[model samples]
Target chain A: MRDLELNMVFDPSEVLRPSSFQDAVETLDSSDSKIVAGNTSLYSLARKGRLENIKKLVDISKLGISYIKEAESQTSEEKKILVGAGTTFQEITSSSLINGRPEYAGLKEALNKSPPQIRNVATIGGSICSAVSFYDLPIVLFALGTTLKFFSKKEGEHLITIDSFFQNPALYGKSLLIECQFSSSPNSASSFVKLCRRMSGYAVAMTAARIKLDRTSREIDDIRLVIGAMTKTPQRLNQVEEELRHKEPSIETITRMCEKSADLVHDIIPSVHASTAYKKRVLPILLREAITTAVERATER
Target chain B: MLNETRIKVRFILNGESRNIECMAADTLFDTLRDSLGTMSVKQGCDFGGCGVCSVLLDGRPVYSCLMPTWKVEGSKIETLEGLKGKELMNLDAIQQAFATNFAQQCGYCTPAMILNAKALLERNPNPSVDQIKDALSGVLCRCTGYMPIVEAVMQAAMMRRKKTQV
Candidate 1:
């Protein structure tokens, strides 16, 4: 079946290049119209005959949304980074603004998950909208508390939290994702860990953790723990976060909580590559590593 | 019957401007191998998983198999064909190093490996062992165990550096 799909030819009828957001939205409103950016996933899907219904291809690469800049935050105490949807993983990984910053360490690691070839063309917007469970960026972005700005014919323009967006991505179908913004706070850092059979291979289990430490108390003030590649969608381990909050971070306590949380995980999607038992066994180790690195970075800041 | 729509795509290939009409869904891999006859861009995995179809797009290495033909409009593309020397005896530094170091076995992945190394050398004149590994990690080479390829890239970087000093 896979070989047959690979041999199939994909030929679309028309390709539309929209220069403005309004024009893109209008084109997307038409039936059987789909947006193409990077063309990494779209081309593969088309070759596999998954996009047979897609007749009109709207090339949104020229929509003028490829950018990464610092935006003024609502509060003076916080700093926000706005990343255009069209920005590729390579761009994000090499950005001086994102690199060397402890707050964005997890994002940089996630962006480096893919090799140079894929990273050079795969855009962040496409990665998020695709909503593939095993993708590294979505899991890290969720832990970083990212918010998406999308445009639809009905809503015009609105912002949705990354958490909510992943919960029901189909609800925002036919909408144009403009950009994503995440706030960076002082004494905060993030880390991502993935266990793959080989380098750059699909993750059997992965975890992303972000920690915000109280400057005075040096305690874990707030934390976000997200685990992926073991389920249909990345899930947040709220119980573990609640257990660690306002407490001094230690290897023993974190290991204990993560181990307990791993046992509580149910409904794990089995894979031919990795068994459910093996994934469950390693989930706690990945969680401990991610949290440990995040805590270490937060303290260093 | 399938609806067919072809449009003219203009790009600079091998330092020469080219304009070709192709289907809306045609990938850069198809345009290069079928339309332009640049056979260096091998077609391995139609998807982006395999890097045998790698090429330099505007000085950055990308998977040509995953790039749409329309996306390369007005951009610069370079493949192994463009890196060859004018004469048969003379070869590009990377190519010469690969030949001397026995970098290739079956030679199927040589073009992509050399092209990826070329891009890395152009960006960083002197790359470390880890840097070379990171650059060539995308291209899968079943033979030679990759040590020879890494040595070849390192040697090529030195050769280029010596040439500039002279």
Candidate 2:
């Protein structure tokens, strides 16, 4: 029999319902708390005794937050897609907005690169909240310049830029996440690339790039690039984007920018993966391929 | 010090209402097989790495092995047995296709596979091979590979189309 003394499973509060986050929080407040969503990754942790620290679980399955909403941007005339924290990667990839949106190539591509089982059960909220480097969605969200709306028990509701969101994920201690919103840009093309050992596993390296090129001028109007599985968290390469903002989307300029990215990655990320040496050697190659693919996609439409 | 005790949770399982008093630590998988005697939902891997313990909660497919039974109160639960006699199964399209296509060798993985496929076809009546692969990718089948399983789904789709025409 399992030892109940060392690893105690606390009794849950019966009043909590599936439809309320507040209720879920109340349950967590009563004892040592852990939140359950999808549980694909969490269960493994529990079974392995990694979560021996946790005694109470806050179930978030019925929080009524699993949704994909397209709302008009208040400042910009563009429309933004808001994905609830409970929205699974599978739901996002298969959603009509992602598959049908010509400009959302990066989002669709990132979803494709993620593993099958993880895609099915891994939620956008849980993945982002974990802040793991290998997660596929963060790079895309950061590249799209997304915003996260966090709900904290102490501070109530607060909004943070996707870049700043990763800077510190510990802000929301007891409260939960609501959703992430990213306004769709006009005349944009996106691409996502992953260097993984197989079809379904954590990424060794990954990149999500969104590029908008002026057809008449052939100059890059706007660009965003985010890299994951390289550091403490997914990073948005703002310096590289600044370098390529007005330049023509040519081979020489692209290669230079990619090289700069490799240097930045090398300096920022320590203890890279087992494939780190090989990844550093081939960073530019993958970056160039991703950029080229994004450019091609943008030009097609 | 915090006091731990059992919590009472009630939900509908396979069209019957059940009230299960369990510890918050007890997962839906454990409650079903041990407490409720619904052994159809096997525990291939309790860690959720294997999708063998998949069940339908409120009509969506989820791995029961990881979900807490206490969290499922007031929610509707359906297992492989629920699908066995449903009108959709009686059409016997997919199950019949599986039988005809030699989709099972060991047969241990069939229930999970069927449930996964059922969930997919419900969402998308006719999914491409790529989409089918995506849908069932969470499930692991150590026997017959996936080609025969894929062919069975395709044949089932064709049969559904045939029935629609008549």
Candidate 3:
């Protein structure tokens, strides 16, 4: 209901500009306020006549959260790519730290598929918050097992896993996203694929798959499979992952796993654009293709 | 109840510092075209769909239609006006290339195409044909069938390369 109130103007008296990180967190303590990062999607939504009920847009684009680099994560000493909430898609697409790792190629692929102008302006944190199905990068972020870092002046910083964050987006929406980090697994191979009516159009359905085979060669040691656009949010297929993990990825086994995952997806997301029947029919194939690509990439490594 | 608050934001606009009172609702597209008379930044869809309002914000191509005017503080903005070369009568290299290559019809998308192309050529002097296509992928040309525009960018690259070599 909050998305439909229209024609309301964003008067300057309401917009708060916080100069410091701590100040931004403190300012965001107000439950009604929304954060603005790059303002791409929010601007688009307003142009499309959405967000009518919203009054205040706290501009966080300048709150000193802009960063993109590999750093030692707080919970673990392992090196992870810590992309600040304000880090633009342009930064992510071309970040040498992200591109340097073979596992992040999936993220690079998804971000690259976004139009050039969008890449130059839209921030990854904004994309994560938008959580719309057709936005391609969320699928990759989910597939990569990314974790988001949120800061509140009162609560300090909380690192929420992607799975948990999506399960309760509203709980974290008001909080400021400071960084999103993912374990950089050298042994893993990741792939992202999307089907759209037009070459540069928004995705109809997208999949991002990451596969890590055991050193012994045949067994899939770890895997993450996520699908997007069939629903309001990106959905990770845990059952499908469970079926494939710690086992040889045979053609028959992969096919069965994809079928079961596709079935499971029908119960999860109320399908759109591509009908439920269509998505159910095609999910397994796309998942197969993405996983197959990841598997091959893993074998090459 | 809309609160009437205006902030004086300063930015380098076309090589000169200009201060303007920007409201929260004002977009860069509105600020440039409405307030400052920068007609080069066209409002096509008033959203990101049409890249007609593209401008170089700090030398990177971004759709000005969506960029909040309040966000322009301390940033340098370049429109087609900034592409006016050395002399009063002279044209930018990309503009010249577009003209020589017959890259305009109604000319609505021309400014954005030129600016986005210019941003591309600045970072990548000698981009391949595919690279050129990849760079200009955002700026849409509905009238010219895109070949001439793509050729114009290639020619501009060549011209820039030639100028550097000489």
Judging by lDDT against the true structure, name the best candidate.
Answer: 1
| Candidate 2 lDDT, A80-184, residue by residue in tens | 788999898889987888886657877887777654545666788887887777877788888888898877655666788878878876655566777888876
lDDT of 1 by residue, A1-301 (tens): 0122333445567889889888899997766888887777887787768887777889888888899998954576578989999999998888887999998999999888788888888899998999888988899999999999998878877999999997888888779999999988999999999988766767888999999999999999999999989989888888889999998999999999989976778878888788888888888999999999999999998
**What tens digits encode model 3's per-residue C-alpha lDDT throughout A1-301?**
1111223633334677788768776766665566788787776676555655456678876677788876754344245778888888888777778775668888888888766788887888888888777788888999989998888665788888999888878776557788888876556789998988754568778899998888777589999999888766788888889889998878788877887776686554434466777777788888998998888888787
TM-scores for every candidate against the unseen true structure: 0.96, 0.85, 0.92
Candidate 1 chain B, which ten residues in sequence have the lowest lDDT sum? B1-10
Best by DockQ: 1
Give the docking tier of candidate 2.
acceptable
- Provide the RMSD of all predictions against the true structure, rounded to 1 decimal: 2.2, 3.8, 3.4
> Candidate 1, which segments miss by more than 4 Å at Cα?
A1-9, A73-76, B84-86
Chain B TM-score (each prediction, in order):
0.97, 0.87, 0.95
Winning candidate number (TM-score): 1
Sorted by TM-score (best first), the order is: 1, 3, 2
User: How would you class the docking of model 3?
Assistant: acceptable
Between candidates 2 and 3, the one scoring higher on DockQ is 3
